[model samples]
Every structure is written in structure tokens, then in C-alpha cells.
Target: MASNHHRLSGAPVAAAVDSAAVRITGLTRSFGNRQVLDDINLTIARGEFTALLGRSGSGKSTLLRAVAGLDHGTVGSGEILVPERVSLVFQDSRLLPWLKILDNVVLGLPGKDARGRGRAALDEVSLAKRESAWPHELSGGEQQRAALARSLVSEPELLLADEPFGSLDALTRIRMHRLLRRLYETHRPAVLLVTHDVDEAVILADRVLVLDDGDFVQDLRIDLPAERDPGDPGFQHYRTTLLGALGVLPAHRTKEQS
Candidate 1:
């Protein structure tokens, strides 16, 4: 909700929360002597959608893994407060070869009624009909939907997504984005998505943070309405700024997008 300038644009949108959702203070990570993250401080609000935007090797994914407890000792000098039950959606499906789509989702569920919940998740992603099919039998989009369902089945408080839709084609990716928004709207989980696409972040995230070499280079809020058009002036301005923040230039603009 604030920029790097130590100035408040307006009052924080989220308040009166018992938990910080996911808080990281002075988080740093290194392999050998090569530092990946350096003094990263981030606070993800409860039930908020935040996108981590950066080019390859920006350490955004590393930060997500550290919070998920997957990075082990790679994280350095940081305190990550997250729920015990965490779920992550990777770029690949990682589905079981023998299990069906529904079964894959139910993997994280408790023994009592995992099947029912899995079926519901598939229905949520419009993949209910494919529940009985094997992972190999599903299309690429369907496979990604199954992966999403698997991650959300446990209903974790913090969702770590690393390019969940990167493998899909353009149309499929757009549909997946719409589906993701609907799911996030319903579940209201604190989400941190690591993506290389600035446009995707602009369209889906409440706020976008651009990272460079494991440090936050630009912190910005999408200020445009939720139901904003990509061609709208405000939306375009924010997108232009974000792309510029990532060091990407507009197609026709002469000077760099500043």
C-alpha cells in the first residue's frame, strides 16, 4: 500500500487483522557467497492479490520458496510468518501418472472427504467433467487447472504461484487468468504470484512489485478499477510504467517508457 519513498498515498486498505498473513523482515538468501536476496522486507496483507514481477533470475521465485519452507537453509536473515499448511503451484503440473485428475487434487486433502472437495475444485475450474480422466489425457489448460485445484484443495492461507500459466498458449492463458480471478475472489487467500509478464500482473494483481537481482526496484499499486479495460488511459499508464520499471520499452515510443 506504500511506495519506497516512505510516503503514504492513502490509508492502508487492509487493517484490523490478527495475523500479518505473510510477513518477511530483512529477508536475505545466498548460495555460497553469492547473495540472491538482500535485505528484502515485504508484508503481504490477508486476502490480497499481489504480483511479483521481474525478469529471469530476479530471486522472486526464491523468495516464494523461502516462505513456503521449501528453500531450507537458502534463506538468510529473515523472518517469515506463514501458516503451517501451505500450498504452491509450480510451472509444471507435477501430476501423478497413474492417478486421475480428481485424485491429484485430493492428494492434499484429509482422509475424511477429499474426493468431494476435489470434485468441487474441478467444478470451480470448469474441469468437473475431466475428473475421471488421467493426467495424461487432459489438455494443457486442463492440466494447469488440475494443478491449481491441487494447490487450493488444502485451502492454505498463503498461496505461492510461480508462473502457473506460463506454459499455456495465449487464449488459454487469458481464460486461465479469468478463472484465477474468480477463484481468488471466492477464496480470498493472500496470493504471491511470480511472473515475467508485466501485462499479466497489471491485469490480475491489486499491486505489483518489480524486483531486480533480489531487491525491490519498483513498488506500485494498480490504482485502476478492477473492471478496467487494457486500453483505458489509466490502465495503460500503469502498464507502461510497470513495463518501464522492468526495463521493457513500448513498441512505438521513441524514448524509453519513463
Candidate 2:
């Protein structure tokens, strides 16, 4: 993991957008008659930051793969269509060892202007200076940023993120949150983020959906303002509400802090 796109660490996203970027109807998946995802009906709107919340085995990641066309269905029914493009940013950076940081970002792109696009993506994350650097040389944050650069350089129409910041420390995670929010506003892609962090979902998503036992348990539109701060009372209220939606036992708290 350390040798590859993981430099230490890391969308055309849009401002004004239209309808749902990816729509799923009766989306179900099974493993030898054991259902993993059961009747998932959801719509992810364009230019919207949406989050999928669930426990480890709730099939959140599996749903993401299905959307990405990375996995085939066994007994489900659904379609993922994109006029532009679709891409996924996994939990790990997944960089190539032989490729330089910039080259890795340009992996999917043409070699000509790949570096340029790579640089721009890095600039968005404030890691442009590390352009020529090796993946193994960067800090965890930088590596993640580089990985993001690679993902965004493709200018995807639909962006799927699977707990991209799950491994970061509190401070780093918050920083990544702010970075993502800014990039989302700038690049403006339709985002479907799958995260275990309730606070993260509240902070980053325009709408939050909870998956329980392979099906959606709660789907809520966040009425909180975009400029919401974790320290603010209104934000806290909304965060608490999201926690409740996640079926928090009132005893064990969501690991994600505001």
C-alpha cells in the first residue's frame, strides 16, 4: 500500500446541476442465495454530495461497486448510466509503484496533457508543488491528495467515494473534509460518498442515506446550510439528528466527531 499511489496520501464536479446522476431501482445482490443488498432504490442527483452510511457488512461498498460496474449482479436489477464518465476513489490510494506521483494521477488520461491536468488536480488540493515527487515520499495527507488528483483528473460525471478519509486522524480528516467541500464546489461532480462516519456524512453530504441490513433504513435531506460549522449549535443539532438516523444506541457514539 505504501509503495504505490498511497504518496504519502490524497472532480469535474459542477455548480448548477440537473437530475439524478445515477439511479438505482430494485438494486439487489446475493452471494449463494444469501442477499447482501436487498431492494435498494435510490437516486443520486447531479452536483449533489450524497453519503451512504452503514456498518461494516451492510453492503455499502458492494453497492458502490455495482454502481461503478466493477461488479456484476447475481439476481438484482439496476443500471448506471453516465453522459460524461464515472469513477471510484477507494479507501486506499492504490498508486502504482513504478509511476511518479504526477504520472500516477495521469494514469487514465492521455500522456500529453496528463501532467498538466495532474498538476491542476494537485493544485486544487494544495499539493501542486509535490508534482514530480515520488508516491512513497509524501506524507499520508499528500499521498491521499495525489490519489484524489488522479481520480479528479478524469473529470468524472459521477464520483463514488468509499470511506476515503476513514484512516486519517481527526485533524487531518477535518482538513480533508474542508478540502473536499471546496473541490466539490469547484469541480462540481455528482458525488456518492460511502462512509462510516455520521459526522462526516452530515458535514459533506447534501443528503444522507443510511443502509441497514442491505436496505435503506433512513434517507434524509439535510436542511443545514452549506457554510455549516461543527462548532455551531445548528450544525451540532443536525449532526445529532444524523446520529439518530444511524440507529445509534445512545450508548456507543459514532466515531466521527463534529
TM-score of each: 0.87, 0.85
User: Which regions in candidate 2 have their CA more than 4 angstroms from the true location?
Assistant: 1-18, 73-75, 250-258
What C-alpha lDDT does candidate 2 achieve relative to the native structure?
0.75
Model 1 has an lDDT value of 0.78
Worst 10-residue lDDT window, candidate 1: 2-11
lDDT of 1 by residue, 75-152 (tens): 366666665546788889899989988888997578778899889888988899999999999889889999988888
TM-score, prediction 1: 0.87
lDDT digits (tens) for residues 1-258 of candidate 2: 001010001012222224767666667787777888887777777788899898878898888877776663245554444335766787788888788888888876976777787888888888878878888888777787887878888887778899999878899888888888888888898899999988898889888888888898777777777776888876776676667656765524433332
For candidate 2, give the lDDT of residue 66: 77
- Score residue 65 of candidate 2 by CA lDDT: 74
lDDT of model 1 at position 15: 27
